[model samples]
Target: MLIRYSKILLTAALGALILLVAINNVTDYATNYQFVSHVMSMDQVPTGSPLEWRAVTSVTLHRLFYAFIIAVEFSAAALVLAGAWRLLLRRKAEAARFNAAKDVAIAGLALAVGLYLFGFMAVGGEWFQMWRSLPDAEQAAFRFIGCAALVMLFLGQRDD
Candidate 1:
Protein backbone atom coordinates (compact mmCIF):
# COMPACT_ATOMS: atom_id res chain seq x y z
CA MET A 1 0.00 0.00 0.00
CA LEU A 2 2.74 2.39 0.99
CA ILE A 3 4.67 1.47 -2.11
CA ARG A 4 1.62 2.13 -4.23
CA TYR A 5 1.31 5.57 -2.73
CA SER A 6 4.97 6.19 -3.44
CA LYS A 7 4.51 5.24 -7.05
CA ILE A 8 1.49 7.49 -7.41
CA LEU A 9 3.28 10.41 -5.83
CA LEU A 10 6.37 9.95 -8.00
CA THR A 11 4.24 9.84 -11.11
CA ALA A 12 2.49 13.00 -10.09
CA ALA A 13 5.82 14.66 -9.40
CA LEU A 14 7.10 13.82 -12.83
CA GLY A 15 3.91 15.06 -14.35
CA ALA A 16 4.22 18.31 -12.48
CA LEU A 17 7.79 18.71 -13.63
CA ILE A 18 6.77 18.20 -17.23
CA LEU A 19 3.86 20.57 -16.84
CA LEU A 20 6.18 23.20 -15.47
CA VAL A 21 8.49 22.74 -18.42
CA ALA A 22 5.66 23.22 -20.84
CA ILE A 23 4.48 26.29 -18.99
CA ASN A 24 7.97 27.73 -18.98
CA ASN A 25 8.32 27.15 -22.68
CA VAL A 26 5.04 28.87 -23.34
CA THR A 27 5.70 31.74 -20.98
CA ASP A 28 9.20 32.26 -22.26
CA TYR A 29 8.59 31.32 -25.82
CA ALA A 30 11.26 33.43 -27.47
CA THR A 31 14.13 32.23 -25.29
CA ASN A 32 13.46 28.54 -25.74
CA TYR A 33 12.48 29.11 -29.34
CA GLN A 34 15.94 30.51 -29.94
CA PHE A 35 17.46 27.32 -28.60
CA VAL A 36 15.32 25.26 -30.95
CA SER A 37 16.17 27.48 -33.85
CA HIS A 38 19.87 27.28 -33.11
CA VAL A 39 19.79 23.51 -32.90
CA MET A 40 17.82 23.19 -36.10
CA SER A 41 20.04 25.65 -37.91
CA MET A 42 23.12 23.71 -36.83
CA ASP A 43 25.16 26.88 -37.18
CA GLN A 44 27.21 25.96 -34.16
CA VAL A 45 28.25 22.65 -35.61
CA PRO A 46 31.65 22.68 -37.29
CA THR A 47 31.22 24.68 -40.48
CA GLY A 48 32.78 22.13 -42.81
CA SER A 49 31.06 19.07 -41.45
CA PRO A 50 29.33 16.84 -44.01
CA LEU A 51 26.23 16.68 -41.82
CA GLU A 52 25.73 20.42 -42.17
CA TRP A 53 23.48 19.70 -45.09
CA ARG A 54 20.98 18.20 -42.68
CA ALA A 55 20.33 21.51 -40.97
CA VAL A 56 16.78 22.86 -41.01
CA THR A 57 17.30 26.53 -41.79
CA SER A 58 13.70 27.54 -42.25
CA VAL A 59 12.22 29.70 -39.49
CA THR A 60 8.78 28.20 -40.07
CA LEU A 61 10.09 24.71 -39.51
CA HIS A 62 11.80 25.74 -36.28
CA ARG A 63 8.56 27.19 -34.96
CA LEU A 64 6.67 24.10 -35.99
CA PHE A 65 9.16 21.82 -34.29
CA TYR A 66 9.05 23.83 -31.07
CA ALA A 67 5.26 23.74 -31.14
CA PHE A 68 5.33 19.97 -31.53
CA ILE A 69 7.64 19.64 -28.55
CA ILE A 70 5.36 21.76 -26.38
CA ALA A 71 2.34 19.74 -27.45
CA VAL A 72 4.01 16.45 -26.50
CA GLU A 73 5.11 17.82 -23.15
CA PHE A 74 1.58 18.95 -22.38
CA SER A 75 0.09 15.64 -23.46
CA ALA A 76 2.51 13.64 -21.34
CA ALA A 77 1.81 15.79 -18.31
CA ALA A 78 -1.93 15.44 -18.71
CA LEU A 79 -1.75 11.68 -19.00
CA VAL A 80 0.55 11.24 -16.04
CA LEU A 81 -1.42 13.56 -13.82
CA ALA A 82 -4.66 11.89 -14.79
CA GLY A 83 -3.12 8.52 -14.01
CA ALA A 84 -2.05 9.73 -10.60
CA TRP A 85 -5.58 10.90 -9.95
CA ARG A 86 -6.94 7.54 -10.98
CA LEU A 87 -4.48 5.78 -8.69
CA LEU A 88 -5.35 8.05 -5.80
CA LEU A 89 -9.02 7.27 -6.21
CA ARG A 90 -8.28 3.57 -6.18
CA ARG A 91 -5.60 3.58 -3.52
CA LYS A 92 -7.57 1.46 -1.10
CA ALA A 93 -8.65 -1.05 -3.73
CA GLU A 94 -7.14 -4.47 -4.27
CA ALA A 95 -3.65 -4.86 -5.76
CA ALA A 96 -5.03 -5.91 -9.09
CA ARG A 97 -7.21 -2.85 -9.32
CA PHE A 98 -4.36 -0.55 -8.42
CA ASN A 99 -2.10 -2.22 -10.93
CA ALA A 100 -4.71 -1.83 -13.61
CA ALA A 101 -4.76 1.92 -13.02
CA LYS A 102 -1.08 2.23 -13.91
CA ASP A 103 -1.54 2.05 -17.64
CA VAL A 104 -2.03 5.78 -18.17
CA ALA A 105 0.97 6.63 -16.05
CA ILE A 106 3.07 4.13 -17.94
CA ALA A 107 1.99 5.60 -21.25
CA GLY A 108 2.84 9.11 -20.08
CA LEU A 109 6.26 8.08 -18.84
CA ALA A 110 6.93 6.29 -22.09
CA LEU A 111 6.07 9.44 -24.02
CA ALA A 112 8.43 11.45 -21.87
CA VAL A 113 11.21 8.96 -22.40
CA GLY A 114 10.56 8.95 -26.11
CA LEU A 115 10.59 12.73 -26.22
CA TYR A 116 13.95 13.06 -24.57
CA LEU A 117 15.62 9.95 -25.88
CA PHE A 118 14.45 9.89 -29.49
CA GLY A 119 13.21 13.42 -30.14
CA PHE A 120 15.95 15.41 -28.50
CA MET A 121 18.97 13.15 -28.24
CA ALA A 122 18.73 11.14 -31.40
CA VAL A 123 17.32 13.83 -33.65
CA GLY A 124 18.69 17.03 -32.17
CA GLY A 125 21.92 15.70 -30.73
CA GLU A 126 23.00 13.33 -33.47
CA TRP A 127 21.13 14.35 -36.63
CA PHE A 128 21.34 18.08 -36.07
CA GLN A 129 24.65 17.79 -34.24
CA MET A 130 23.33 19.74 -31.29
CA TRP A 131 26.08 18.15 -29.22
CA ARG A 132 28.62 20.30 -30.99
CA SER A 133 26.89 23.48 -29.88
CA LEU A 134 27.83 25.59 -26.87
CA PRO A 135 24.44 25.50 -25.19
CA ASP A 136 23.64 21.92 -25.96
CA ALA A 137 20.62 20.25 -24.33
CA GLU A 138 21.68 16.63 -24.86
CA GLN A 139 22.74 16.26 -21.23
CA ALA A 140 19.46 17.70 -20.02
CA ALA A 141 17.55 15.37 -22.30
CA PHE A 142 19.58 12.41 -21.02
CA ARG A 143 18.83 13.30 -17.42
CA PHE A 144 15.11 13.67 -18.13
CA ILE A 145 14.98 10.33 -19.96
CA GLY A 146 16.85 8.62 -17.13
CA CYS A 147 14.49 9.92 -14.48
CA ALA A 148 11.38 9.06 -16.49
CA ALA A 149 12.67 5.55 -17.24
CA LEU A 150 13.44 4.89 -13.59
CA VAL A 151 9.99 5.97 -12.52
CA MET A 152 8.41 3.83 -15.22
CA LEU A 153 10.32 0.79 -13.96
CA PHE A 154 9.32 1.44 -10.37
CA LEU A 155 5.71 2.02 -11.29
CA GLY A 156 5.56 -1.15 -13.37
CA GLN A 157 6.20 -3.41 -10.34
CA ARG A 158 3.21 -5.29 -8.97
CA ASP A 159 1.58 -3.68 -5.98
CA ASP A 160 1.43 -6.78 -3.87
Candidate 2:
Protein backbone atom coordinates (compact mmCIF):
# COMPACT_ATOMS: atom_id res chain seq x y z
CA MET A 1 0.00 0.00 0.00
CA LEU A 2 2.80 2.37 0.93
CA ILE A 3 4.66 1.63 -2.27
CA ARG A 4 1.58 2.19 -4.33
CA TYR A 5 0.89 5.50 -2.70
CA SER A 6 4.52 6.51 -3.06
CA LYS A 7 4.48 5.88 -6.75
CA ILE A 8 1.24 7.77 -7.13
CA LEU A 9 2.59 10.71 -5.11
CA LEU A 10 5.81 10.87 -7.07
CA THR A 11 3.98 10.87 -10.37
CA ALA A 12 1.50 13.47 -9.16
CA ALA A 13 4.27 15.75 -8.01
CA LEU A 14 6.09 15.36 -11.28
CA GLY A 15 2.92 16.12 -13.15
CA ALA A 16 2.35 19.26 -11.13
CA LEU A 17 5.89 20.44 -11.75
CA ILE A 18 5.67 19.83 -15.47
CA LEU A 19 2.32 21.58 -15.65
CA LEU A 20 3.70 24.64 -13.88
CA VAL A 21 6.63 24.66 -16.29
CA ALA A 22 4.26 24.57 -19.21
CA ILE A 23 2.23 27.39 -17.76
CA ASN A 24 5.31 29.49 -17.21
CA ASN A 25 6.46 28.84 -20.74
CA VAL A 26 3.14 30.02 -22.01
CA THR A 27 2.48 33.01 -19.76
CA ASP A 28 6.06 34.19 -19.61
CA TYR A 29 6.79 33.41 -23.20
CA ALA A 30 9.02 36.37 -23.99
CA THR A 31 11.43 35.78 -21.12
CA ASN A 32 12.29 32.19 -21.93
CA TYR A 33 11.97 32.90 -25.59
CA GLN A 34 14.77 35.39 -25.19
CA PHE A 35 16.80 32.81 -23.35
CA VAL A 36 16.27 30.40 -26.20
CA SER A 37 17.05 33.09 -28.72
CA HIS A 38 20.35 33.98 -27.12
CA VAL A 39 21.34 30.38 -26.59
CA MET A 40 20.54 29.34 -30.11
CA SER A 41 22.20 32.43 -31.54
CA MET A 42 25.24 31.89 -29.32
CA ASP A 43 25.47 35.64 -28.77
CA GLN A 44 26.40 35.11 -25.14
CA VAL A 45 29.41 32.96 -25.98
CA PRO A 46 32.85 34.52 -25.85
CA THR A 47 33.80 36.47 -28.93
CA GLY A 48 36.48 35.48 -31.48
CA SER A 49 36.11 31.72 -31.00
CA PRO A 50 35.93 29.32 -33.87
CA LEU A 51 32.74 27.87 -32.35
CA GLU A 52 30.93 31.02 -33.41
CA TRP A 53 30.22 29.34 -36.72
CA ARG A 54 27.92 26.90 -34.97
CA ALA A 55 25.52 29.61 -33.86
CA VAL A 56 22.02 29.67 -35.29
CA THR A 57 21.39 33.37 -35.90
CA SER A 58 17.90 33.05 -37.21
CA VAL A 59 15.01 34.28 -35.01
CA THR A 60 12.62 31.89 -36.73
CA LEU A 61 14.61 28.87 -35.65
CA HIS A 62 14.75 30.16 -32.09
CA ARG A 63 10.96 30.46 -31.88
CA LEU A 64 10.56 27.04 -33.45
CA PHE A 65 12.91 25.40 -30.95
CA TYR A 66 11.23 27.10 -28.01
CA ALA A 67 7.83 26.00 -29.25
CA PHE A 68 9.02 22.43 -29.51
CA ILE A 69 10.24 22.54 -25.93
CA ILE A 70 6.90 23.89 -24.68
CA ALA A 71 5.10 21.14 -26.56
CA VAL A 72 7.20 18.46 -24.92
CA GLU A 73 6.67 19.94 -21.48
CA PHE A 74 2.91 20.15 -21.96
CA SER A 75 2.75 16.58 -23.24
CA ALA A 76 4.75 15.28 -20.29
CA ALA A 77 2.45 17.08 -17.87
CA ALA A 78 -0.69 15.59 -19.41
CA LEU A 79 0.77 12.08 -19.49
CA VAL A 80 1.89 12.14 -15.90
CA LEU A 81 -1.40 13.60 -14.66
CA ALA A 82 -3.33 10.86 -16.40
CA GLY A 83 -0.83 8.27 -15.20
CA ALA A 84 -1.20 9.39 -11.61
CA TRP A 85 -4.95 9.04 -11.89
CA ARG A 86 -4.51 5.58 -13.36
CA LEU A 87 -2.23 4.57 -10.52
CA LEU A 88 -4.78 5.79 -8.00
CA LEU A 89 -7.49 3.75 -9.66
CA ARG A 90 -5.34 0.60 -9.72
CA ARG A 91 -3.81 0.98 -6.28
CA LYS A 92 -5.79 -1.86 -4.78
CA ALA A 93 -5.17 -4.25 -7.66
CA GLU A 94 -2.56 -6.99 -7.71
CA ALA A 95 1.05 -5.82 -7.71
CA ALA A 96 1.76 -6.96 -11.23
CA ARG A 97 -1.35 -5.34 -12.57
CA PHE A 98 -0.62 -2.07 -10.82
CA ASN A 99 2.96 -2.11 -12.06
CA ALA A 100 1.80 -2.69 -15.59
CA ALA A 101 -0.18 0.54 -15.39
CA LYS A 102 2.99 2.59 -14.89
CA ASP A 103 3.84 2.84 -18.57
CA VAL A 104 2.28 6.29 -18.99
CA ALA A 105 4.17 7.73 -16.04
CA ILE A 106 7.37 6.20 -17.33
CA ALA A 107 6.83 7.82 -20.69
CA GLY A 108 6.33 11.18 -18.98
CA LEU A 109 9.57 10.78 -17.08
CA ALA A 110 11.38 9.88 -20.29
CA LEU A 111 10.11 13.04 -21.94
CA ALA A 112 11.32 15.12 -18.98
CA VAL A 113 14.71 13.40 -19.08
CA GLY A 114 14.93 14.12 -22.78
CA LEU A 115 14.11 17.78 -22.25
CA TYR A 116 16.33 18.67 -19.29
CA LEU A 117 19.16 16.21 -19.88
CA PHE A 118 19.38 15.68 -23.60
CA GLY A 119 17.79 18.88 -24.85
CA PHE A 120 19.07 21.53 -22.44
CA MET A 121 22.26 20.04 -21.04
CA ALA A 122 23.49 18.30 -24.15
CA VAL A 123 22.18 20.37 -27.04
CA GLY A 124 21.88 23.85 -25.54
CA GLY A 125 24.67 23.66 -22.96
CA GLU A 126 27.34 21.79 -24.86
CA TRP A 127 26.44 22.21 -28.50
CA PHE A 128 25.23 25.80 -28.27
CA GLN A 129 27.53 26.73 -25.36
CA MET A 130 24.65 27.88 -23.16
CA TRP A 131 26.78 27.13 -20.13
CA ARG A 132 29.09 29.96 -21.09
CA SER A 133 26.29 32.49 -21.24
CA LEU A 134 26.47 35.45 -18.88
CA PRO A 135 23.44 34.13 -17.06
CA ASP A 136 23.89 30.42 -17.40
CA ALA A 137 20.94 28.10 -16.79
CA GLU A 138 22.97 24.88 -16.76
CA GLN A 139 22.66 24.62 -13.00
CA ALA A 140 18.89 24.78 -13.12
CA ALA A 141 18.88 22.40 -16.05
CA PHE A 142 20.89 19.84 -14.09
CA ARG A 143 18.65 20.27 -11.07
CA PHE A 144 15.49 19.65 -13.07
CA ILE A 145 17.07 16.61 -14.71
CA GLY A 146 18.10 15.26 -11.32
CA CYS A 147 14.61 15.69 -9.93
CA ALA A 148 13.11 13.78 -12.84
CA ALA A 149 15.68 11.00 -12.45
CA LEU A 150 14.99 10.65 -8.75
CA VAL A 151 11.27 10.39 -9.37
CA MET A 152 11.87 7.87 -12.12
CA LEU A 153 13.98 5.74 -9.82
CA PHE A 154 11.26 5.77 -7.19
CA LEU A 155 8.63 4.86 -9.78
CA GLY A 156 10.74 1.96 -11.06
CA GLN A 157 10.56 0.15 -7.72
CA ARG A 158 8.37 -2.95 -7.36
CA ASP A 159 5.06 -2.24 -5.68
CA ASP A 160 5.08 -5.67 -4.12
Residue by residue across 28-107, what tens digits does model 1's lDDT show? 99999999999899998777888889999999999999999999999999999999999999999999999999999999
By lDDT, the best candidate is 1
Report every candidate's CA lDDT: 0.92, 0.90
- lDDT (C-alpha) at residue 93 in model 1: 95
| Model 1 lDDT, residue 26, Cα | 100
Residues 1-160 of candidate 2 have per-residue lDDT tens digits of 8878988998899899999999999999999999899889998777998899999989888899999999999999998888899899999999898999888998998898889998999899989999886335998888888888889889988777
Write down the TM-score of every candidate: 0.97, 0.96
Q: Estimate the overall C-alpha local distance difference test score of candidate 1.
A: 0.92
| Over 4 Å off, model 1 | none
TM-score winner: 1
lDDT for model 2? 0.90
